[model samples]
Target: MKAIIAKSNIGGVITTPPSKSYTIRALLAAALASGQSRIFNPLVADDTEAAAEVLTQLGAGIKRQTDCWEVTGGNLAPPSSPHQKLNCRQSAATLRFLAPICAALQGTSCITFAPGLARRPMTPLFDIFQQLGVRSELTENSLNIHGTGGQFKSNEVSLPGNISSQFISGILMATPLASEGLTIHLTTPAESKNYLRMTIDCLQRFGINVEYDDNLEEFRVEHQAYQPTDYIVEGDWSSASYFLGMGALSGPVTVTGLNADSFQADRFMLNCLRRMGAEVIINGDSVTVNSSPLRKTDTGLNEAIDLLPSVACLAGVSAGESVITGLDRARLKESDRVTAVADNLKQMGIKVIEESDRLTITGGTPRGAVIDSFDDHRIAMAFAMLAAICGDTVIEGAECVNKTYPDFWEDFQKVGGKVSINE
Candidate 1:
């Protein structure tokens, strides 16, 4: 689907969607417990659905309801049929977090991935499996894993922390089910440290404990069991960024249902907008932003790489040049976000300088142009705000937003955005 945008004023109150990261973590944790667990306000999107399907294939019973999901877990077994494979459907989080869990099962397990996920880096996690005496075979689109069946040969493992936080999270979630306690040593400082912290927080909700040092370079997990309980997913700050950017560029927009003290890294979007001289107001769980003349601010996105597309668009209309560093890992996301952002901005008559790990965008009066979303959700949503600022902007592959925020277009319209959808 394509979305055509025209210049217009947008302002209103729209609740943020539930956090996808939290929903997936809660689902996996619930599936690890012995009793049935209830997950409330979960994000019912494609990625979360992929995780739920894989969990069901692994012997967990999941029943979906209108407002919540009931998951009965702790009796996980590989599919009885040899042809039955766990398919992750382009969700890297589901694949990474479930791979290690599958390695702890008794029988052999086969996992398949979509073409896009096949391009992601998985060697680090694969190496850790070898260190733990688990046999794993990897191909372009499929993985064959032979499990230790909860009795890993080795308990100590080491991997780089800079690659993907999901690797660390995968290990942390699975190690608790091992026969012996496990220790993980990080080779480098971890980027996106908040994500790892979020994983530990989710584990604690299920009665699992994780210990780490100040720098977060080392982690220790004791062999334990998960206790089933009701888990509630919080609102996503990542999804709120697009609307907040719109408010800064257009008018007084308010986003509700967010926890101001969330550990989610994207909560820093509020700070970034404030740094750009945008008027921001916080009233308990709701945040309101008023249109202001933005000024360029230099920053690093190492911790919040997902915000690259939205922040880049914000910089495109600011006064001075903005430089965002620590984007080396952003290239490994659903798309080459750094390149996609630069290319889209250039097409909109903005001056942008692109590098391997940084993007320098000079603010100017952006003119509307056709935008290629790279079939990426963040790219499509981020460019939507720019489209509202400069009319006649058509975003190809607008349907990609269903991967995370399924109602993004509807919410865009509710906030008074002038957009037409071409299906």
Candidate 2:
């Protein structure tokens, strides 16, 4: 689908969507728990749906009620009867996290994905799985996993941090079920440490114990079982970043339903915008941001790569050129975000310089152009905000925003932005 966004200044309060990161983890934990688990304020996104389907394939009973999801956890075993192949599409979180859990279950199972995810590198995860005595094979777009129904041996494994942290998080989630537990050692400084923190925090919520030694660079997960509990998913800070950018570009805007102390790395967008001279006020679960003249300065945003797309939008309207660095890891995301942002911005008649790991956006008035989303949700939302400044910007695959925020276009229109969807 394509969408044409007409220019207009943004205003009004927007409630952030439920956190995909937290919802996925909470759903997985509920599936692994021994009893019934209720997940409140769940994120109804494509990725979360993929996770729920995976759990159902692995012998968990899930029922969606009015506003909450009810998950009845059972033994962590693959279906006893013949099962249909699982399709994860392009959800990297589901593929990375569920693959290990599937490998640990008893029975044969296979997972296939669409072109986008099929091409992503899974060799790192394969290596880690091999060390845990799990056998898997990659053929075309399908990954066939056979479980031995045996305990995994604990070992010290070092992983590259520059790729996706989901690799480590997946292994960490499965390690608690190992017979001897597992110790993961990072070979390099881990980027997106905040995400790992979220993973650990979610594991603890489900009754798993994980110990981190920062000085030693080791994360140890003790062998334990997950207990069923009610999990409440908070609002997504990543989604809130777009509205914050809108406020930074036009006028005051308040985003409700986000926690002030979210573990999401994108929450740091508040700090980055403040550092760039935007007036940001946080109250409990809401944040109010007002437009102010921004100053360009070299800012360290390594921990907040998820906010890069929205940050690029804000930077386009800043008074001076802004340099965003330490984002080499962004290439492995849904799209080569670094290149996508630069390419999309340039199409909108903005000057942007791209590097292997950095983006230098020279702030100036934007002009309308047809922009490609690269089939990424964040890309679609980011350019939508840019349209507010550029006027008549057309976004191809704007429906991709349904991956995270299905109501994005409607919410944007409610905030005084006009969008025409072409099916």
TM-score of each: 0.99, 0.96
Model 2 ranges off by over 4 Å: 81-83
In angstroms, the error of model 1 at 18 is 0.2
Of the candidates shown, which would achieve the greatest TM-score relative to the real structure? 1
lDDT per residue for candidate 2 within 223-248, as digits (tens), equals 78888988899999999899888888
lDDT of 1 by residue, 85-135 (tens): 999998999999999998988889999999998888988878989899899
Give the range of the ten consecutive residues with the poorest summed lDDT in model 2: 148-157
**lDDT of candidate 2?**
0.84
Candidate 2: residue 319 Cα off by (Å): 1.5
Best by lDDT, which number?
1
Error of 1 at 375 (Å): 0.6
Clashing pairs in 1: none
Q: Which runs in model 1 stand beyond 4 Å of their true positions? A: none
List RMSD in Å for every model shown. Answer: 0.8, 1.6
